[model samples]
Target: MEWLERMNRAIDYIEENLTGDIELSEAARMACCSSYHFQRMFSFITNVTLSEYIRRRRLTLAALELQHSGVAKVIDVALKYGYDSPVSFARAFHALHGITPAMARQDGIALKAYPRLSFLITIRGADAMNYRIETKESFEVFGIEGIFRTDGDGEAPQTPAKLWEQSHANGDVKQLEARAGVLPSFVSQDLYPVNAVCSYRKTGPDTFPYMLCAFKEENSNTDGYTTVTIPAYTWVIFPSEPHQWEQFGDTIETLYRRFYTEWLPTAGYEQVDGVEFEMNGTKNGLNYIELWFAVRKI
Candidate 1:
């Protein structure tokens, strides 16, 4: 199936299972990608997490049922939508619609609704994407790792920055740099940070491991640091532009948003099962960064 069709089918699957158990695995299956890639793509394209999208959809439907169904019990409606108890349902419902279930039954109560989503291919060549496709062999990286939750908003989360600060304060970054045998040459600085997803299947809803890392030799002793192996795959690298330091985060976010939303459906490529990473560097006195995603031809 085509990428757009696969994504639309995923949305259809979610709609069909809204009143039942909706598994990320099932959605990913329909989308023809791994759960991690599907979730990441969905968030980047829709600007909301999968869990958040599901919750809003469920609450939206629940509000409609409450407002229109004259004799339906609140507990029945809640249980139908996978809420274990009325209290939990009420909390979620109020959070989304800003009105209680009982209040929704009263006349003229306005409720917000999250409509079903569909995918389309939009031709967006206004801003040329500075990216290239390359294949690389398996490599190892040694780094200091920390757990971080990616926020729903496009902004970079503060947790990774905090981890970097902690590592610097404790001298772990310097120690790692000193022990490094094969340093990352992309950056002029001695320390090169690579943020990567840990394990796709094991990652929590919002949490993944972020690593401040450098390339290491085969025999290098990684006594205190965590070592991760990046498997060989074809990667699409998005190189940063010069003089965009002030809009760095926003630019990266826009690139991602465009890549997933506008590019993927027509790119004739699909993301493979692997961790994605961001490379932070500097070149010729300008800040440089690149996003790397493992992919395969569709």
Candidate 2:
């Protein structure tokens, strides 16, 4: 099935069963995909994580009912929305809407509502993406590494680029490059706790450490450099258009959106790993960009 259509079906299912128990795995099954792929694709396509979207929708419905319905107690409303206890429900509700349930009930407080979502795919950009599938054994990369947080979904923090920019500006880029052996990879976990994202940290005084790393197998001979050998795996390598120099963030976003919405489902492949990264090819007028995403056959 087309991914968008399957996503639409998933959305319908969530709306229909909003007041009942909903399983993440079951939702992916309904979409005819694996839980990992489904959740990743959902985040890529919608720019919102699956859990966040669900919570918003549930809270929206609950808040509307709280204001309009004759439900007497907030606990009843919370239970109806699948919360185990009023305290848990109240905390979540307040976090999302900026108002507690009792406060909403007492004075009929107005709250921000997360409306139901529908999937819609649109194409606007004219640039063609350059990408290919790669299969290789594990390798090592020597660079800097750090961890950062994603505020809501998988949003990129300002840290990564700032690190890169500072390195470039302070002439630390050349020093690191002298020690740079292989290109690096970005390692990430599929399921992260709420509001926390992995960050990047400098590896050494001269060399920035790469948390998620990648490199050719033959170049693992750097002095004082640790080796992180990745297992043999398949990857999707995307070459960015030459026109998007210094616009790494936007270019990557566009690529992910397309992969989630246009590729993947139709390509008959399922995502297997959270390991993703970019290869800094020789710069060409600030437009040469290539991104690599690790994947495996499903």
* Deviating ranges (above 4 Å) for candidate 1: 146-165, 182-210, 218-221, 243-246
Worst 10 residues of 2 by lDDT: 190-199
Candidate 1 TM-score to native: 0.83
> Best candidate, lDDT-wise?
1
* Number of the top-ranking candidate, with TM-score as the measure: 1
TM-score per candidate, chains pooled:
0.83, 0.60
How many angstroms is residue 75 displaced in model 2 relative to the true structure, after the best TM-score fit?
A: 5.1
lDDT of 1 by residue, 39-142 (tens): 87899998888889999999999999989997889999999999999999999999988988889998888989889988876656687777788888887877
The positional error of residue 220 in candidate 1, measured at the CA in angstroms, is: 4.9
In candidate 2, stretches whose alpha carbon ends up further than 4 angstroms from where it belongs are 2-40, 49-51, 75-127, 145-175, 182-226, 244-246
| lDDT per residue as tens, model 2, 219-256 | 43445533454566687867666555557678767777
